[model samples]
Target: MDERKIRVVVAKPGLDGHDRGAKVVARALRDAGMEVVYTGLRQTPEQIVETVLQEDADAVGISILSGAHTFYFTKIIGLLKEKDAGDIIVFGGGVIPDKDIPGLLEAGAGAVFGPGTPTSVCVEWLEKAVADKRAKEQ
Candidate 1:
């Protein structure tokens, strides 16, 4: 993780049409010197996973405003595991309920940001998480 840039794919998954938060977070990550690919709205779990793999990202940040957080998270994580790409860290954001946080984590989300979470916070967390992941990989 030294000279190599931390690359991440930011996606909006499921029927969630809202993507303002995702774009803001993407910009913050880019501003923080990370490579960010923003996969726009209405992405299927399979598509997101494909983009992550194709981009060779260190992590993926999914933004979903729909009530289908459980389904999307489970499907994406399961797909990554199936593809033997479970090392790509998964994180999520949007209108998800607090009660669902633990379940999302169990489903393999590294973190979940609810409404009102600062983009800076997401950027900071992602930086540390990606760094830790890279360290472990070595």
Candidate 2:
């Protein structure tokens, strides 16, 4: 497997109009030599899952800043599992509260980055998560 060319799908789900962070993270991931497919904004969980399938992505990076992280994250994870797409590592960033992090992780999200997290941190964690998931699948 190509370690440096990790394929990622960056998605903005629900009515979250705040996309500045998503764009920045997408650019940073691209700069890190990862293939990034970004969904502009206002995407549904179904749409995001479809994008993942179409891209054949190894991981998904969701950006949620509309205080709807739990809702969207749970929905996406649930739908992904329902489709037997559990091999795809799910992670995200945004204004996520500390209290909700555990729930998100338990819901099949490999990681969650809160506000003030560096882009480099996300990039590193994403790579490791993808590698780990791939290892488990094998």
The C-alpha TM-scores of every prediction are 0.96, 0.94
Write model 1 residue lDDT over 1-138, tens digit each, in one string: 356899999999877788888899999999999999999888888899999999999999988887888889899999999999998999988889999999999988999999998888888898889889888888
- 53-83, model 2: which lDDT tens digit per residue? 8899998999998889999989999988898
Clashing pairs in model 2, backbone N/Cα/C closer than 3 A: none
- In model 1, the runs with Cα more than 4 Å from the true position are none
lDDT of 1 at 70: 89
Count of clashing residue pairs in every prediction:
0, 0
lDDT of 1 at 29: 93
Most accurate candidate by lDDT: 1
The C-alpha stretches of model 2 lying farther than 4 A from their native spots are 1-4
Clashes of 2: 0
Q: Could you tell me how far off, in angstroms, the CA of residue 12 lies in candidate 2 after the best superposition?
A: 0.4
RMSD of each: 1.0, 1.3
